[model samples]
Target: MKNNNSICFISFFFLFMFMLMNMVFMLYFLMNNMILVLEWEIISFNSMNIVFSILIDWMSLVFMMFVSLISSSVIFYSKSYMSSELNLNRFIMLVLLFVFSMMLLIISPNIISIFLGWDGLGLVSYCLVIYYQNIKSYNAGMLTVMSNRIGDVMLLMVIAWTMNYGSWNYVFYTELMKDDFSMEVISGLIILGAMTKSAQIPFSSWLPAAMAAPTPVSALVHSSTLVTAGVYLLIRFNNLLMSTDFILLLLLISGLTMFMAGISANYEYDLKKIIALSTLSQLGLMMSILSMGFKDLAFFHLLTHAMFKALLFMCAGMIIHMMNDNQDIRYMGGMSLYIPVTSLCMNISNLALCGIPFLAGFYSSDLILEMVSMSNMNMLIFFLYYFSTGLTMFYTMRMLMYLMVNEFNLMSVYCLYDEDFVMLKSMIMLLLMSVVSGSFLIWMIFSYPYMIYLPLNLKLMVIYVVIMGGLLGYLMSMMNLYSVNKFIMTYKLSNYLWLMWFMPSLSTYGLNYKFLNLGQNLMKNIDLGWSEFYSGQGMFFILKKYSIIFNIFQMNNFKIYLYSFVLWMLFLVMFMLMMI
Candidate 1:
């Protein structure tokens, strides 16, 4: 126990120190407008230089700072959260490995090195997701890893394609190759990879499924390390992507993903999965804005979102811990009456998520909606952006009502309190950042404020939608058990919404059923039937039958011997005649 505590403290201290260092470096780089690239050539063959390269700039440094801060806090929180686990040391090591991989991904300018980090993130996250060693965790881990594998394959394709340029340092080529057809293809491949990593539309199922991981892992992976890896990669490649029609494809996919996640979150009952869906929705928002060539805004939102989302997960973890691992929101009610501090943190983060005025989320999400209004886009996209935004508020408010306002639904004898200082400390840190990080990032990232020229209705549209969504959320949550069951009346629609439009089923059984059935048929007809008959068992049967028949013939030893002797005598006589 002492050893485990020491390990946790050691890791937390180092990560915190590194976070401060990164913050200082980030400020320096932002002030001076400088980028530092450190390169080491591994090999030179056929004019292609295989080099390991690191890029140090404001963007990477700021991201590193945030990642380090979140990771350190999670580690510290885990000391209490995972204290009963025997292999706590292994968990810490895996988390450290995950953070290291993320750092590698953040700092690398070379795609090869980036791939090393990308693959590490996938593998390590799989380990974390299955940390509980249960069937659900195993299934979720498989889904998470397999979904990420698609992105890995895409990245491998990108690495192979970039070899044509004689160098895998994409930093050197993203701008120069913008007009090249091959580069456009590479950009598409990169988008596909990012989609899987960030959990875009088709790839979005894994994000919610991945909530089977421990809450600390959820806080780290969903917030900064794993899912955001895709968004960060896209941010890096924004120049190449913005130059082509692929941006439009990204735009459409991201918008749909945002809407799907928002709607799914509202229907979800599991607390962690609801939060995971919200993460998915936010990721969609980031990707959507980035597609529209607002990389800075996307990044700003990413950072701010990370702060609050991590805090939200930590608060959820605390609540779950107090609830004795029951994650169902239906059993949670009037939590603020018991664990006021945690409930306060949760509410603040939720409000931030809903883009409440002056909150961290508001700074980025509001700006994004405003920018969307200003841009020249069709009505469909416009509707998606605002509707998804409304859905975000709706789900958040609904969740809050279930957790804070409704009558207490748990057993009367249960113990729920906010006395865990370790957890509280971490949550408070993130809570502070979630409050201030947005405005701070805006000042740091942009040289000039965005000019908004909008009509009165357009300016108030966000407020109107949020208010409407909140009202609907409250009304929905207020429904009584004796009241009519709306889901029963709209069974199909409810099921569709509750199941994330059947995305998980589609990604899993929907995709694998036919192939699995084909494999079963092949095994039966080919390996078990035809191949067994023609080659294996049939050949053995034939050989055994012939051997038995020959044995039976040989059993008549006297007749066999007489026949052989006659044949020999005839042969001898014929040979003598010929010789004569």
Candidate 2:
């Protein structure tokens, strides 16, 4: 094989291993496990040919296909996007490692292996993000590494508890399904780990921080590799997630994340960071759906999101490369005239991302929305979700409008339209698949025997809702009522409204200093309190002034030997008395 910097070899290698791994697991499942074929399992298995896990079923195969597809796209994107970058071989190696870990994560028969894959992906992603080793990249990498490690530690505790009380197979979180005291405590801890990895609510700070990497790395981790590891964990423990306590926590976190991230993305200027926030919203939506017992819908969204998001990121990368690393949409206008193909790919991707009709995003997002609307959450949750979806479309269309529709300021000209054909070709291929695959995937999901409870016919109506949402979003963008609008200073309203959602990020920033000062004050107070109580200039202190009598006497060698002999004699006498 010719060693090219921009080839798809590593991705292809991961895909091959993904297929092989699933095949091996499927054979094992059929050979040993009973074939009851739950309707849901059948639904999951029917989507893709490969099935791997403790029991190779429909769900496993579907996830396997997602990992393979997204990975392949990322690898193809990486080739041309990273052509001129240094350490090309090592980059591919890390990419291979990341894909392998995700594959291993999903296929592992037990929790231990899944966690191993989970941690592996985190490790590889951090390294890949900082491949350039600059200060900003290193800082982002370290932040992500620390957050992920905290989650890993929580997971390790869960595993330990499981092994101590439940079976070590850890295959299904089967132990968590039990009503034992220990299982109850341990299950909560496990969900904590999931929240961290999935970037749920409070743990989501690390995600936006991670956008300092190369665009391709952002595409991979934010889209398919690292952030979604939490979703994988949730599905793997579907049985546990069905429980009321865990479901509530998942719902709370997921809902908050959806609302929070949408607003944050609205405020963001860096193109990659906006995409990163969008991933957070998408993951939150998936997590919320999964918590509502719609695992299939969640997984479907995950698969589709990966396709569109990877395309969007890659398109952004192409444009960024042309514009000399300027990722701000403020400087990006008239790109549609210069790079029509890339612009179209990105436009279609944004449409899909906003769940606009017929594209990949619509099918998945509508399904999740439908499923969520059916849940018992209050009206506030419903409003949050609906508004968040609107925000999703709002920012996405804002990006598209800025890049493809707005007039270019030719004065600050830097780009000369040197598009990489290899990169363009790969993007075009994914663009086609991203548009067509959503419906096919929806069909595959509905075709399964187990999803009888789900109404496949609602897809059309769902598509209609998606279209309405996207149209509203587009009109708002055009009217200059939102971020992209030049005439309307929606800024004043956005400042207040958006801040309601974004206060968490602001508060977190402020709290960092407050917490540090509070800790120092707390320690100082404790020292003073302790000194007053234990070493005060009072009666106790006065007694301590003459406490030498309570201490052991200092003696020369001969006197010390005499003291030791006396202690031995007393011990021997005591032993003899006891024996007598």
Q: Using lDDT as the measure, which candidate wins?
A: 1
Distance (Å) between predicted and true CA of 519, model 2? 13
Task: Please provide, for model 1 over 12-33, each residue's C-alpha lDDT reduced to its tens digit, 9 standing for 90 to 100.
Answer: 9999999999999989999999
Error of 2 at 566 (Å): 29
What is the C-alpha lDDT profile of model 2 across 303-390, one tens digit per residue?
8888888888889898888777788877778898888878888888988887777888878887676756566778877777777887
Extract clashing residue pairs from model 2. Answer: 39-450, 44-58, 44-59, 45-58, 480-485
The weakest ten consecutive residues by lDDT in model 2 span 34-43
lDDT of 2 at 94: 83
Displacement of the residue 233 alpha carbon in candidate 2, Å:
0.6
